[model samples]
Target: MHELVSWGRVRLLGEAGVQAGNDATTPAVKITVLGSGYVGLVAAAGFADAGHQVQCIDIDVARVEKLRRGEVPFFEPGLREVMSRAIRGGRLTFGTEINAGHRASEVYFIAVGTPPLADGSADVSAVYAAAKTIREVAEAPAVVGIKSTVPVGTCDAVQAIVDEGARVPLRVASIPEFLKEGTALADFMKPDRIILGVADGEAERVLRDLYRPLQLSSERILVMDRCSSELSKYAANAMLASRISFMNELSRLCDAIGADIHAIRRAVGSDRRIGPQFLYAGPGFGGSCFPKDVSALAYQARQAGVPLEVVEAAGRANEAQRVYVRDRALSMLGGEVAGKVVAVWGVAFKAETDDVRETPALPLIRALVEKGAEVHIHDPEAADNFVRSYGLPVRCFENEYEAATGADLLVVMTEWRHLRNPDFPRLRTLMRTPNLFDARNIWTTFELGKSGFRYLGVGTRST
Candidate 1:
């Protein structure tokens, strides 16, 4: 695979086991990944791919065994092969125990998930639990790297957790990932920026030495205080999520008036100011990061006596976007939702990821089922997860057309790589009627015109 060789130069890139030149990087630390879920596994695999002596630790033995066998438990495009090669080559090792890992590792990265809670805050119990384990067994003076998307005071909280029971000083730093799930390896090796929040003396040199590869490439590595680093990650996601919500609001406007959003987007993007990224309208934003991180930030902000009105508004807008798409689908089907056969193209939150934690398709599927529609769904990697979660109220299709066969309508939820281009001839044959719902507005109105399908795109005005 291209991924295997592409990452061979990885030891020359980011902060795992980067090559050294100037008076540093002598005796690079043993990097350890704590957790084996999407973020944890990917981070672990990437560092191992980077030629670092990486030991991946998780509580789940099945997950660990899967990694050890080169069979990735999830569907990340380049992850499986790369992890497999590394595991085969003895650069990467997987274990279920945490204490042995802590004793052996020099840089312990905590990449566990921070699922949301009822109190509208991030439940960071997993992170604290990991720290408690590290405190009990670690023999080495380690820099605890937090690669998780945590709340603002999280690194500080982790520091307190470790320090409270720790015999030696357990330094904690935030190195939050900006990776889109499927493209994690690419993002990790060639990131736009690398964030490091550390206290002045002890951890700085270790961090600087570790990240010499990125410095060579001249990528911006922002070195800030630990708290700022933690907040920066949530703030970054909030801004991106807000942009999606903002455009979805405009999408509704485009539907109302006789305005094509594609034209407007082109016109607006032509200016140097707005740059046309995250500008497309969709069936609301979903996936693992946006909803959880934004809500977590909002909660943290409220606790600090400053409610994030704008961010909270964006979250509400994203939720409404899903409702808007469902209503539009119902409206296009002449407002009678019962006995409707709706074929949905993509089920994962966003393309290139199997993660459907808060995917729009899940909500829309639930709505379609409630309204008595026979929902047929298709996704590259999310089908199994969807089936496991929802338990087959909707039919899972092997191919896109199979899902579309005899359907009254089609809803394109996630913008998968292949779904951007479709076989209109086959699509027409499969459908009961020629109604298409373009939630991502991927297909042009001109293309739809030539195809002779009654199209309902998210932002574009109906001609």
Candidate 2:
């Protein structure tokens, strides 16, 4: 059996926000996922792992070929193993198009990317294209669940397109994804809550049956209107971003008053009202979700003439934090680091994933290069993606030891687990001058002063 026993009812109580219930498994159904990006691939693999026959379609021919060999293009923890198992068991497959063979699937999931446009609005052309293809090729009646992050009313708009085009009866639902990058597979396998935006009972029943395996232990699924479900995703991301910005702003005040943010965060977060999740005061929030969602939410509000002042302020604060981190690092080197060799540790936005969409490290690295500092960067998995995004001239190292060698300063951008406890003695001996900037505040307990190193931490200026 491909049953993943790791997700138990005990772990699902607070995290999944549901009480333990009786087991209710449904018959396995054929599923097709449009797009092979983060959301599509994870959803496909996760469904297949849950005993569903899943077919994932993508336009990228090369990417499909790679997956056929049980190789994942991006870095996500535990996804490759699950996907390989599903493929070897003949339950999961990939292709470049949705043809006659795929029409037998009862449910189709649209998990394509909705990239932001110049005005911060989500360019949903890819979503529309996927919908158009589904409308043209679906031979049998199917429920199309949109797992893409889209603006409000997107589901209704796509439904209208399918209504006018499709010959067979079709139902459309908005099922926005809440999977975090690093733990996307886990997030999908065991979600906090499954939001199903359906117009009628038929669509609801279809999705509920498809998700019976996940809901067996607890019924955490929530059924709501399409527009509300669409807005819920944006609101959740904005709220999380606001929390980070609020903490970051407080961290600045803490620095000015000679108070430690670490202490304040603990005291404040201990309250039941404000639990400690995204409350860490760091170099600000980054990755694929927060930045884009915040911008999109703010833009949507402004377009409607009811500006989201709180979200807008959060965006400004986040941008300011980025600038502050960059300037602080430069100041440590006597305010002019034109000829210094600075080593950057952890380039991915966060740990456990290789997604560097809007990572704060990009701005710092770009500024360093512009100021003539020789940048030596290293990440366990994201260096190649980073280099591909910004083709700036810099030294990319395979190992942290190589990157930190002969460096005047070392900046920790992402809080990778392995980066928390490093060979400080070796790093001290390798570099010309020992200056450590902990942007993620992962080393708050470390005593760098006694070890002959100048340590700088975000929101806590000691050791």
Candidate 3:
């Protein structure tokens, strides 16, 4: 974990009159972040580390108290250390409700969750609730920046809510968060670009000043209309998901032809137009962002009378890819998963985060269980979260080796670095049957066949 900002450095800067904008001339501003989830807590801590006073508010009182003591409920690397340092620096605080202190702040950021509804549209009730709270408590004019992932025109809707019999002028801006999980802190501290969707100049200036510390290296802030900014968040995630789905679709063809998708990826990704990122073939794309964003975008497109067929197809492919993997794993067990012990190596959507919102492992495990396979799941960081997400009857193991013990087949889902180089010989010895299913293609070069194990990799030829 690179130390983005330390307590001593921030305290000394505060003493020397240094502020958030990276310009000593500007004064420090007070910031209040709503909903101490991944995005909110990270933004609050990053702001406080930049010498600004931040108060993070969450409706969950127990969660707030846990954060106040520097305990992060979820797994995020380097966040607890920075959050603790910010709290000790007297610049970061947490509370259950928005009080007068937050009302007096210069900026209030709503980073609440916009969970997907049954129809795939984002349920913006939390966003509206946060706006209402800010409206009721705010005594002074403040820029109400929305860091939540909401549908387009959400900022306008929030502005209307704040404008309804308001005592203070609230400038609504759609500052949708672009922080990725597992590296959220670093992404916040050193962002690629800060998208500020503002209706007016005041909202723009307020957000720009708040993020100026991160922009010292380059002018990475992109200012646009609120509607465009709101759509940009969904568009970005959908584009990434499209790339992933496209690759997964091609991977199926590669497997059918006995051609390696790895080489195909290199051949195609080198085209400069098609980048290498998100090109890796895996079970499917999942997490809190990709699935929900894709679904919401498709939903919004339908509502607007301009259906996004490509985006919807990508989502379908993603769902099908999960089923394909599950079916492939069952086929490896002689067309019957009943009375089989199956071990899953990684459960998180990807690696490095405990978020299991739409992890492929869940559906695969569920299908295996339904087929009467005894499932054992293991993940370095996401075991607890997976267990919570999946209240189903399955064995949760502390280590990968333990999970693989006595298993008829082992499946790799997330590509954790630690899963890259496992003791193949030991794994072969531990399993009841030496069957290795490399879903992420992490062990393609391991030559498991030489170790007396049958290896099956996605889009790779088994030796």
For each candidate in turn, the TM-score is 0.92, 0.94, 0.95
Arrange candidates, best TM-score first.
3, 2, 1
lDDT, candidate 1, 61-168, per-residue tens: 888777767788888888878887767756678888754533756678898878889876888899988888887777666778888888888888888888775655
CA RMSD of all predictions: 6.1, 7.0, 5.3
Candidate 2 lDDT by residue in tens digits, 240-283: 99999999998888777888889988999999998978889999
* Tens-digit lDDT track of model 3 for 119-141: 99999999999999998887767
Error of 3 at 324 (Å): 0.6
Residue pairs with clashing backbones, model 3: none
Superposition TM-score, candidate 3 onto the true structure: 0.95
Model-by-model lDDT, in order?
A: 0.79, 0.86, 0.86
**116 Cα displacement, candidate 2 (Å):** 1.1
The window of 10 residues in a row where model 1 has the poorest summed lDDT is: 1-10
Query: What's each prediction's clash count?
Result: 0, 0, 0
